[model samples]
Target: MKKLELTAQAEDLMKSHSLQGFPNEICGFFYGKTVEGVKHVTVIKPVVNAKEGDQRRRFAIDPLDYMKAEQFVIAEGLEFLGIYHTHPLHPAIPSEHDLKQALPSFSYIILSVQPEKVVDITSWTLNDDRAFEQEEIISNRNVNTSANKAS
Candidate 1:
């Protein structure tokens, strides 16, 4: 299992978005640098959920958003680590929909939000067997300065 290093500021930003979008899933992108084999998520870039169905149980992001994130990260000298989304009433576990949509080399961070509060956060990565493997989340209070500086 790999480690998902989430900065304190990033955590707060995600939780806030989750709370604001209560009863519906909120999704976004994250960028960072890998240090010591850990996926350090630095910036939480919020974007509109472009799913075509009910958002309470489903969340989707457009491919263009990924390109934008990649470009921003490259311009800022960081890697496109992965993306994040909120599960309003579910655990911080990936669903079948998520597993099916997931790709390689990206960390998927899921936040469990109950009512208007964020209850938990977990990260996952697809393994060789195509199974979702839960990755340990490290709440990093002091990530690199670039993360702090990025909006």
Candidate 2:
């Protein structure tokens, strides 16, 4: 597993989506360079909420969305890093269900929009033990493109 790096715009997109999801989990795909020690997130594409639960904002990407994301990455010459989702009113960690579904190689970024007043974002790696271990996500504002990075 590796520590994921979010471009400023990517981070901003995640944060903004989290706010929109408010009481739910905002799910999406992250594309860029996937490697050990350093993972770069160049793009963020939001996915639809498909889970059965209504209380949680976390969304399970639609199958079409997954296919679209994969196609988009290839079209843009980018690598598929992994998926991101928000944990409303909870810690930026994966739940039991999340662990069961996640792959060890992908970077899972969880935004904890909890405590009501403040929102905190964090990243993690799902170890072989199926536990989510915290990882650091450094944001770089130097790169600019069509993606919105403003906070």
What residue runs in model 1 are displaced by over 4 Å at the alpha carbon? 144-151
- Top-TM-score candidate index: 1
Model 1 pairs in collision = none
Tell me the whole-model lDDT of each prediction, alpha carbons only.
Answer: 0.84, 0.75
Q: Who wins the lDDT comparison?
A: 1
Query: Candidate 2, residues 1-151: lDDT per residue as tens digits?
Result: 3466777788877778777877877787788876566887887877767777784744676687788777878898888888888888887767887887888778788888853432677777777887788777777888652353322
Query: Per-residue lDDT for 88 in model 1?
Result: 90
lDDT of 1 by residue, 28-138 (tens): 888878999988777778888888978998888888977788888879898888888998989998999899889988889999999968988999988988898899998
lDDT of 1 at 46: 83
Model 1: lowest-lDDT 10 consecutive positions: 142-151
Clashing pairs in 2: 9-149, 24-57, 25-57, 25-58
